[model samples]
Every structure is written in C-alpha cells, then in structure tokens.
Target: MSDMANNDLEKYAKALDNAIMKYHGLKMEEVNDTMRHLWNKTYQGTDIDGIKIRSDVEGGASKRSYNYRVVMTKDQVEMDMRGRCSAGQKMLASIIIRLALSDSFGQNCGILALDEPTNALDVENIDALAESLVDIINERKNHSNFQLIIITHDENFLRKLGQAEVMEYYWRVSRDSRQKSVIERQRFR
Candidate 1:
C-alpha cells in the first residue's frame, strides 16, 4: 500500500476507536482487544476456504489488500484452500479499522453514519455489533465530541438503544398525494 493509503487507513482506525471509546465509556485499548478476539472467533475454524479484502481506488489510485485464512479439521483430511469474500468479516474489519483510526487522532469528526450495518449479520454477530455501537456512543457522550446518524429498519434494535441513550426518532409516512417525515429529538435533561 502507498503511504497515503496507509495513512488514510490509520486515520480511519483511530477515528472509529475514539468514537466507540467516547460513547461507551470504555478504554480504546479494551475495544481493540475485543475486536481482535471477535475477528478470530467470527472466522476461525469455519468452512471458509479463503478470504480476501481488496479496496479499489478511483482515478488510478493504489489499491489496498487484506487476507484471511481458514482451516477445517473435521471436514477435510488434508489442506484445503479457496478464495472467497465474507461480508461479515469485512464489516467487522471496517469497523475495527475505523475505530482504531479515530482513537489515534483525537480530532473531532463531524458525523458518523451507518447504513443498514446489521444487514445479513447472524444473531451472534448482530449482538456483537450492537454492543460495539453502544460502546461507541457511550464513549462519545463521555467526551462530548461525537455525533452519530444511524439508518436502519430494525425497530427492536432502535428501541433497545433508545432506552439507554437520548435519540432523535424520525418517521416517514405517505398520505394521500403527500409524503411527509416527522423528526422527534430527545436529549437527557
């Protein structure tokens, strides 16, 4: 990877970590340690033959690469390898990388947006993601320097989070020949 790409990755990782730590009232180091463990458990010893994470840069920019190895003992008698892409693994990596970057910079980022982040995630993975997000928000609240805009259709998840944190709820409804959206903002008194 080029220096610029590496730098960008580093920055992203630090930002993500800082956001999580600030929102969740947890240490940055602790979040990183948990991420590492989660990564391993999510993919290790699975039926995964091979895994690759590649980023395509626009305008002739250098690409970035990440690799993962998986081994199955009971399924095979010998070594097996294949190239595949796992969305779950990629999502986790992206979150970890961004967190790490945020943690290092200590700079305030304007907004953090997550679009359907929990999509396609299994129950266990979804729980992990929720925990991570809660931690991030808690950390931000503690530091008073973070803002988040999360878009999702998961009502259950939203309700769970809303109970613990102040949130702005928006609902879009369509009526006869008209479409309108309502926003309800809440804050701790």
Candidate 2:
C-alpha cells in the first residue's frame, strides 16, 4: 500500500478506537475479556468447542478472524464461518462483535434493534443471554446514551429477561383486521 493508503488506514483505526473507548468506556483488554465471557456464556455445552479472535497484518492488507470450532472425538474441525456453527452460535457471535465494536465503525446509535434476538437459542442459552444483556445495559446506563430494543415472539424469553421496570419501554406490535401494523405500548406496570 502507498503512504497515503497507510495514513488513511491508520487514521480510521485510531478514530474507531477512540469511539469505542468513548462510548463503551472499556479498554482493548476489557473488550477482549468481554468477548470471551460472552462467548463462553453463549456456548456452554454440547459439541461446540472454542473461540479465538485473531489479528494478522501480512504485507499491507490486514484482516481479523473470529475462529471457532467443533470438538469431536476423533478430530476437531475448524469452521469456515458459514461452515459448521449452528444458527444460535452464529447469532450470538454476531451480537458479541456488534456490541464489542460499538464504535462509529459499528452501531454507535443510541438504540439497538434486535429482531427476534432469541430465535435459535435454547432455553438456557436464551436466559443466559438475557441476563448478560441486562448486565451490560446496567453497566453502561449512566455512561452512554444506549438502549436495547428486542422484538421477539418467545414469551419464555421475555420472562427470562425479567425486566421489572420495562413497562414504560416495552411495546407490542400487532396487525389489525385490515392487516395494518399497529404498535401498542405497555399500559401496565
């Protein structure tokens, strides 16, 4: 890469780093730890193996990888992203990365919209994820202007969330007889 290209790349990286720290109030080390923590919580059982975040800069171009695998008895096979992991695993990883990179490069918006966030997760995993999200929100509540809005049809997941004061924030979307979408906010606490 040319000097100009390298300069631009560095500038972008620096800006991204600044935003991440400013918004999330977490250092790079903390970010890694958070990722690992979330990953472990998300994949707590069964054949799903391990996860590793790798950064490599060969020559000029650079890349990052979220390497994960399935630990079988005879052989452990590395997944090619769209290769082996289940839907829930993929969704969990995506959420972790999205939250971790909550800088200008990612979703720095004050609002986080998760459509059917617990789609493929099992009961235990869903509960785990809900608890983790609540922890994250509480930790960052006074620090940033961020909110998590989850749209899911799973009643069990909603109960697992256990958001006590969610009455003011929760909303229900439904279709009327005309098939028009109608949004109803929670009227009871």
> Per-residue lDDT for 1-189 in model 2, tens only?
699999998999988866854654344445556566766666555665544344332342244233333221212654445566778877776777666556333445767777788888877778888877777777667657677778899877776565644324567789999999999875433
Global lDDT of each candidate = 0.54, 0.64
Q: All candidates' TM-scores?
A: 0.49, 0.64
Candidate that would win on lDDT:
2
Question: Which 10 consecutive positions of candidate 2 have the poorest summed lDDT?
Answer: 66-75
Expressed as tens digits, the lDDT of each residue in 1-189 for candidate 1 is 699999999899878766754654444345445444445444343553222222222331134232433322233332322233357655655555555545544457646777777666666666666666776677676566577767877766666566655444544333444455545554422
lDDT of 2 at 141: 74
lDDT of 2: 0.64
Instruction: For candidate 2, give the lDDT of residue 127.
Output: 80
Misplaced by over 4 Å in model 1 are 1-85, 165-177, 186-189
The alpha-carbon lDDT assigned to residue 18 of candidate 1 equals 62
